[model samples]
Target: MRRVLLIQKAADKKDAKPEEIKKSFRTMGVTACQQMQGKKASDVEFLVSSKVGSSELLGIFENSFHLTNYENSHKKQPSEEEQEKDKEEEALDKDDRTKRINKKVDNFVVSTENTSVVEDQDYKFQQASARATEFARNLANARGSVATPEWMEHQIMDLLKKHEGKVGEVRVLQADELQKLGMNLFYNVGKGAISQPRCVIVHYEGNPEKKGEVEIALVGKGVTFDTGGLNLKPSGYMEDMYGDKGGSCAVLGALQ
Candidate 1:
């Protein structure tokens, strides 16, 4: 299920009065606006037609409200120092929440339509293990500077060793080795300023009957953080740079 914003546009092209906005929404077939009227909160959630895209809805709100008063009514602005502290605290809180969720184990089946993998194969255990492992990695990755390229390599290699009996063979290529072999895929940005990128491959043969047959190969991008590379990201955009390694962690989870 998806949540969306419902916006009401006033007919008069002037400062919005409460009654005018209600009438406009009622005309537009959004009855909830009248019911939710005069509610005040830092965050607001309301139902809207799936057809109404966020851009259009936000545009309507932008046009109807008195900009300064509307923004100030909800909350006051936080100082830069407060904002940074809040961001760090939020990341730590998320880490704790994920850890708690990972401890709970339950069996569930995923139903898919028109998928390449057979629907009846029933890899539920594998999927559960993968998801838990992924959450752990994601939490670790959320910590700033802890999910570097070298750190990612160590994590992946550790997972390979932890599941040694289940996995067939694991191979790792160090940064210098990768560079010498002309595989400079991840170092285009930050070049020698940061840790050299590394790659790890895990070959798992859960079934000995099909030893020589290969069904699928999955490649995961392991750029631990994207500082927009050499270009660099402006203020607001750089906060979530650590999420760039998501694909690699996902691959690591599946392999584990």
Candidate 2:
């Protein structure tokens, strides 16, 4: 059997010593771990065995998922200080009860073998959720002209129509149509491009009682990949330009 040992990055364990890590390998049942004499702790790589909690492991999975590269990422990895700052983000997200519930759900979904929960709808909806995430990920990661305003329009319409009963009033407006209504800024942005510009509108009648009244309007920008309009970016700086569509892609996924 092949064994895979996960070594925490040197940035995460800044205080670990090289010799100490090598010695700890013996207790971790990784006796074959090799160490070079001149290597620093940061350069040394070895698994530091620990019993990771469910929530902690889930956090690691989320971090890995978000860091996945679509175009063999040209950007440098986050620095130690940057990682710490991410950890320090505002905590007004939820209360303790919600966290406890999340931990329990995460643990159950990952490790439980309870067959009763394996119903048909569970499999179906889980697959749908997976597809939504994948769609959003791909759309946000698409580079170059692979995804454009008109292309995004088609995609949105296809998705909305796929679930026809749920979402209604789907339409695509051309550049001239948008300009007629005084959306010159949006119209001008895509008029020069060969693929042209399009505005996609989707409606969901969640509340039938208030049919005509609007409650929430979600906006997403499908920026032309890397071709910054008037102010162009350097070639190197334009990497992952498709990531600018993240906001809209997220809205699409949530709708899905």
Candidate 3:
């Protein structure tokens, strides 16, 4: 990294396009490797996992490679022959139509800002989606006793804590509490299991500036682990039965 820094500093690095920054880092890596090897580091010889897509690689490296090293035309002085060619090109650039078109093409500040906003939105979407999917998948693979109602409650609590003050209030009603309240559905379903039933109600007001309170609400049953109770599991039917709480997982992630 220090060697690459000594080679050339990438100016307006924060301004480089996603693709441009990626190629620059790859070049920087090869250059650093070549310096150590005392021989050319063939970029073509570079290997990557076949399972990962080019776009996926970019997404993985985006944060680390945020500061790019792009070449600046003004930093390096042009040779006499190159200067002469530039002079000819400058003379030919007197056409107003071409110059106007080129000026418009070069100015991309507004578009770039809009693009960054969209990219951030996309990144957030992917993050929340992954959270939901992972919760469901993990529950599916975990043992029936492991991914219990209490475990699911803890997961949702952790998620709320991670988001901090964004959420308003959270209430977890246990088996005895549900029975007292005359809410028998949740209690009955989870009663058969080792761990008692728990109903988690998360109250979140998404909008503050609006006239009224939260306009929308989501409710889901989080059946963390489901093994056939009295009727024992038969054959392939019992596999991944814990994933039945996908609805609840989706709700938890959507709170993001």
Candidate 4:
């Protein structure tokens, strides 16, 4: 990961070829070679890397290359008009590609929407009803409680089933593994609850052929409700803690 460069000057007494300069560098334990451009003159420049300190490299650079005031004459300057033309060309190319891809996507999306309308009616209606009922119940009885209802596990399972095909496996982490990973934070926070704390992982594969390629990961801290614990909060603050599960809901929504 570290890089060192040794610049050598051209021979003065005798004109040296590029190959000869390269061979000379190899003799000095330079294992890597990099080509460089001379700043002052049209002479060729080189960058060589060796397992040597900067001071040692500098000494080699000075001794190998002859010092000369050779000014570079091949500097290229682009005209304003040429630069503008290149920009216009690039923009046009980008716009054309965007239009083509968008057209294909629009057609496919329309077809998919039409197909779903006819085939997914029954399942969609059932989901809509379930969601409505869940929403109404949460809104009506929004209270902070330490006990986690058994029904929450069923809900989590349902969520996992809904996203099973999209995301590979949904598994709860064992207590020992959780402790080893120092995830006692969740256990500590949820200790007072009647239900024991659980950590769940939702694994997904974006590319099935490339098994290990993980394009995305989503982690949700699902603390159903908070009562401020030992450091008790004001009644108003505790009331709002009932919505601590909002982050969990958001992640489920996005995955769906």
Candidate 5:
């Protein structure tokens, strides 16, 4: 026997037409002859076991109800003249900014020979530290996690490898393990969503040979998505929650 499940949100219940629902189910290759209603926001899972593979069923669900004509209907084609004008304006703006920056640089003066060796060394150290901090911040705020998806992990690892000397080694901890390790404070704030919270520990041992040297440990809070959890937040308050992982991004930027 084939089964079909229709899970609709309370907000969508009134607006969802029967034909649309049926069409969505049918598109998933499931015969929507019956449906069992459930509480709001929960997935309406269907136990479909047939000759059709689960992958196919999943594909149907994924593609079903996608706005087919909306993009085409809403798309506005720019005229050739409009496109040319935009390009010209962008080029002029870029030229103006470059000229302004060059003029500023020309006014800037540096007295390298007059400065003491200690001052020069301290300046270099400060610059290196700032670079590390920026790299760390950028990684923390970077979109997505290297834990859930292998492909993404590979990509991130490759990126880290590119900055091998600066980053050293990148370690991605499992969500459950990270929680057990008492890093839940950062992870728990953005739980209960499709995107899994991850704790990425980026190691940067710039000078490892010296014994008893204090290595700088820069940590950043990475929240993939902040829904304000059980506390609940006003719509406006939650608008900028996407940037909650900015601390981590800052760490990434510093490291870079």
Candidate 6:
């Protein structure tokens, strides 16, 4: 099956109807617009699996898009109370949307009628990959203050353990362990500045028969939370700091 990832702006109004919101997506005339604001990546999988339906379209609206490589638009900073309230409201909206998205993904995964004989062999890999993406998102979406490096390490370990036999191996390099290896040299301003940094290494063979070939190596930075460290971010700019671990998220999703 083929897949596509579309990133679009979130609706202007939170209460906008799905159909109206769908129309606002900048598809550039690709013709796949079914109107879904599901934030999780799995939603894309579902859309592609269904052949984009008879209408040949799907729409995904995203509200939070942060750009580190380019100039970002400036906005007036809201008060602390307003920031907290917005965060809470966003969380609630996310929870509701996730529940609906998962229902669709679960239904798609469990349905066996569409599977072909050849697809059976790849079932485990598919499931593991999807689970990895889900777990990574969980970590990324975790409450800001709670998603520390140590906490994220524990979560990754737990997720890997759940996929035991299917994956070749999983290992974690603890903060002290990394320091001993002089990995601190690679970190900014030395590792002493950041406390308890950890790394998770997942080994899952893409082709079992070619084991030990070691054809590719992937690296991802798992910064559980970025509080701007020494140079803190100004008021409103710091709200979405939890997404600093986005690189690791992509790695986790690609591993399976």
Give per-model TM-scores.
Answer: 0.46, 0.51, 0.48, 0.40, 0.40, 0.48
Q: Say what the RMSD of model 2 is.
A: 15.7
- Please report the TM-score between candidate 6 and the true structure: 0.48
Write candidate 6's Cα lDDT for 1-256 as tens digits. Answer: 4455553444358788656644553242222222222333233332223422212112121111101001112234667887677578668776543432122222222222344521443444434444556555656666657877767666666656756665776777765777778787444422443455567777877577888877577887666554336445678756776677777766766753
For 53-161, candidate 3 gives per-residue lDDT tens digits of 3343323233222111111112346678876865676587753322111111111111122234325654444334544554544444556667778787877887787
Screening candidate 3 with a backbone cut-off below 3 angstroms (N, C-alpha, C), the clashing residue pairs are none
Clashing pairs in 4: 8-65, 9-65, 9-66, 40-70, 40-71, 40-72, 41-70, 41-71
lDDT of each: 0.50, 0.53, 0.52, 0.45, 0.44, 0.49
- Writing each residue's lDDT as its tens digit, candidate 2 over 187-255 gives 786677777777778888766777879858888877767343544567775665668778888788867
What range of 10 consecutive residues in model 1 has the weakest lDDT sum? 99-108
lDDT of 1 by residue, 10-40 (tens): 3555787756654463344323332222221
List model 4 lDDT by residue over 69-97, tens digit each.
11121235657886676577658665432
Candidate 6 lDDT score at position 230: 47
Clash pairs of candidate 2? none
Q: Which lDDT tens digits does candidate 5 get at residues 26-107? A: 4443222112111111123333333322232233332231211011222356678867775786586654322211111111
Worst 10 residues of 2 by lDDT: 100-109
Candidate 2 clash figure, as a count: 0
Residue 61 displacement (Å), model 6: 17
Worst 10 residues of 3 by lDDT: 101-110
Off by over 4 Å in 3: 1-132, 139-141, 226-228, 232-235
Each model's backbone clash number: 0, 0, 0, 8, 28, 5
